[model samples]
Target: MNLTVLRKDFLAGVVVFLVALPLSLGIAQACDLPAFAGLLSGVIGGVVVTLFSPSRFAVSGPAAGLVTIVTGAVATLGSYSLVLLAIAIAGLLQAAFGLLRAGRWIGLIPDSVIQGMMVAIGLQLVLQQIPVFTGAETAAAGELFSPACLSVAAGAMLILLLWQQP
Candidate 1:
């Protein structure tokens, strides 16, 4: 690579580092884990995967999507270290997926359908949590919005909606 490109990449990396710190911390807090764990995952994704990942532009890190996966695994396995073992298994599965190019069909999805799905996901987040805010949390506490925590979560939610409007 050219020196100019390398210099720009270094500068961009510094910015990405700064931008990632708080986002990673917030994700850890939401998932009920120590912030250092999130930082460790970021470090592993940045260093370990860089050695072998074929795609140069793909973002790999402690993802929010893995919240359910990690939590479920923890509940099943009863330890976070065991969750790391599961992650290794998942990493192998993902590497196989990349090698097989299994995501080749992702581009074939209709834009309208994809857009509709995105809209549905957004609405689902609000609707699913509404029951909690209305005081239905007695059903499932650790769920997206627990019945017990619903009353507590309502104010934060109202603020979110109000913040969105203006």
Candidate 2:
């Protein structure tokens, strides 16, 4: 690649690395694991495999979007080693997709469908946050939207309204 293009790629990578740090830590915690795994994966994707990668300006790292899938895989596999095995398998699949140039299919996704998916994700986040915002003490209770929760939530709203001075 040209020197100017390489410099731009390096600059883009610095931006991505900063963003990836917090995202990976959050994802690792949510996945019930240490943050180092995410860092390790990022190092491999960024420095090691990056030499052979096609995307020059794209910085690679552990994505928070995979938290749900990684956590589910760990629960199903019942071991961290197995979770790593699954990750390896996923990498292979991703390589195969790249080899087949399946990335072209991303253009086929309709904007409406993508927007609907985003809206759905937002709703799910709100539902998940309710318990935390209401000071939920027990995750074992399995009641995300209980009467007590709603009452506590209402009380918090009232407090916010009364405390607002500006």
Candidate 3:
């Protein structure tokens, strides 16, 4: 309500947009979907989820964890339209589960299983991004690695490492 609160909220929104925009675009690229699809989904998901969620600090956006499954779904379904239909059905099912208060059962899941799933997701993301990192499409058969691509990747990694330092 106050000016300070408004400023803080605006800053938070900008930070979230900066992080979420590229994540959404990368997820769409990973799934072999159009870039616009990712951008639209990210915006809609963030707005709708933030508006309807009970939690005041919920950050709902396109999930990086779903990249592998989404890619497989698009491939298997052989159409993005079919994948979209499936996603709609899944959303309905999720809403039904929420209404039924099935979230209470989530505590039954083991921590090790959850950790393993996280590790798997991380591995899948790295593996999926390999081609993009190497510029696989542009490189010839005898020359797979591009110096520029490798330099960019190394710089990105260094930045990520430095980001956690302080």
Candidate 4:
């Protein structure tokens, strides 16, 4: 409510945007969708979701786990637009469930089951990126292995690992 609080919130938002931008793009790439789709989704999550959120500090955004499900949906639907329609329908269903207070049922599931699902999602996400990281794009017509791409990926990973040191 105060000016200092507002400034701190703004700074936090800037940090979130910096982190979410590349993450959104990567998720879009993993989903086989254009970069703009990711940016648009991030913007909607940050802006539209914020507008409707009951908590002032709540932040919402896309997750990497969605890549597998979305990729499969696009493949099965055979059209990006159809997949988007399906997503919209799913969102409506989710909202309806939320209105009905269905989230309380989530506690019925065991914590181990939830953790196992998250582990599976994380594993799938890593496996999906293996081809890109290895430069073995299945849809590509040219070289199977690209040293240039590999080097860039390796360099990025090295930098990330170094940055995480305490």
The worst-scoring run of ten residues by lDDT in candidate 1 lies at 139-148
Which one wins by lDDT: 1 or 3? 3
Could you list the CA RMSD of all candidates, in the order they appear? 6.7, 7.2, 1.4, 2.4
Which residue pairs in candidate 2 collide? none
Ranking by lDDT: 3, 4, 2, 1
Write the residue-wise lDDT of candidate 2 on 3-112 in tens digits: 99889878877888789778777667667788897777667766755788668545567754466667778889999998998888987999899999999999899999
lDDT tens readout by residue for model 1, 1-166: 9999999989988888887777677566545568897887788778877787678875556555555556567778987788778889998998899889989978899999989877765565456546546655465565454545764576777888889854
Instruction: Write one digit per residue (lDDT tens) for candidate 4, span 37-105.
Output: 999999987887888889967878888888889999989999989999998999899999989999999
Highest lDDT, which number?
3
Question: TM-score of each candidate?
Answer: 0.57, 0.61, 0.93, 0.87
Error of 3 at 134 (Å): 2.3
Model 2 scores what on Cα lDDT?
A: 0.75
Residue 49, candidate 3: Cα error in Å is 0.9
On residues 46-151, what C-alpha lDDT tens digit does candidate 3 reach at each position? Answer: 8889888999889888889899899999999999899999999999999999999999999999999999999999999998778778877667778887778878
Please give the distance, in angstroms, between residue 34's alpha carbon in candidate 1 and its true position after superposition: 2.2
Q: Tell me the TM-score of model 4.
A: 0.87
List the candidate 1 regions with Cα displacement exceeding 4 Å. 1-4, 55-58, 105-166
For candidate 4, the per-residue lDDT at 87 reads: 87
